[model samples]
Target: MTALIMIGAAVLPSLILLVYFIFGDRFPEPLGGILGTFFFGVLTVIPVLVFAAPLTEVLQPDLLAPIARAATEGFILAAIPEEAFKLAVLVAFARNLKAFDEPMDGLVYGVVASLGFATLENIAYVIGSGDGWLSIAILRALTAVPAHATFGAIMGFYIARAHFEPARRRSMLFAAYLVPMVLHGLYDLGLLATSYSGDIAWIVLGLGTLIIAVVWALRLQRRLRREQQAMLAGTAAASLAAGPHELRG
Candidate 1:
């Protein structure tokens, strides 16, 4: 059925990304913790939708100019509030877990939260499309879902970096919030531009922005994975040298 396909479209991409990041982790997180983070991500959407309506209205102020209003909504209103809430959820619910031991954990939790948000958002968009639900679902699967995952990856990378390298915590913490916020704003701005300009060029710009965002995130993830792998190796060597039963206490 169409509804089933739409659901698949919403969930499958998130799951694929989730699996990719989860497996890449040198220290696997607890399944329950990961699911809880995902659930919190779903919960964050409610606040985003509720706050976004008023925030957009307040930020725009330009009631008569459609393009200006849309652009403002995309960059200032929606991006800031949405990513802010996602960061809040990460800090409040996911960050302090005992399983959050390494840099990869930050990436895992960030992606989990982002994918959860994307999955719910995707379902709504797909269903609202009515007869065109399939096309809508497919389009979002390729674009929006991956975008959220990449944004989350950026957030996670900085968060873990801040944790491991405490001397640089101040800068890394700021980046944990700012990088994703800017990227989200840019992506949304490009999408809104296509509507305002009615030019295929806007679509090209949007796709280009997406490619850059994804590449940036991937590079960060790879670097973090390598660092975590080395840390894990060092920990294992220390543990073995300490003797089998002589655990840290």
Candidate 2:
């Protein structure tokens, strides 16, 4: 019973985020495609582990100050490799597909992909926590899972902009990677440092980072919705203009 509850707690948060992001769209993506993107997201862990393992091996924590060590582990060892692979998966699988016509699609797919990654990570953490799995599960539900969703939203926001404005792909692509990378890194840095030093400040900042991520996601959702609505309204107007005068109604 305990293990079952632990697993549910770990997965439920990411699933909720997934459902919210999917239904939030005016035109929700096809269920089949969303699941496909999610499957690809699950596969992304393979690459992250492959690349991250080597870097982790090389980065000796004793050589640096505690703060610097935390930052290096979070930013360099974890965030860069993980976010890069996720960004690649988003670009490779969904960016050019017919389903990716609107900005909202970017948000949808990005959330899906991020949730997939979070789900896997959650399972690992829960199972690895032994008798204390319940605490680990609850803590991650609040922190890690939502953080992943926020990073996904950030990546997708820029991806949507990049799709609409191809000329700005270079800069937008950079933002897509940089924004989440920094946020995830800072999140990890704070939490990891707190774990090592027993400093409440780092924990507070880490939680603050998650709060910022949630706010940013909400704002991005609003922006994407507005853009989608405007485009739809323009299409309606153009269609009406092309209709016969008597049929204008």
Against the true structure, whose lDDT is highest? 2
TM-score of each: 0.89, 0.91
CA error at residue 164 for candidate 2, angstroms:
1.5
105-204 in candidate 2: lDDT tens per residue? Answer: 8878888888888899899899889988888888888889989998998898888789889899899999999999999998999898887777778987
- Give candidate 2 misplaced runs (Cα > 4 Å): 62-64, 232-249
> How does candidate 1 score on lDDT?
0.83
Global Cα lDDT for candidate 2: 0.86
Q: Which residue pairs show collisions in model 2?
A: none
lDDT for position 144 in model 1: 92
Best by TM-score: 2
Predictions in order: lDDT:
0.83, 0.86
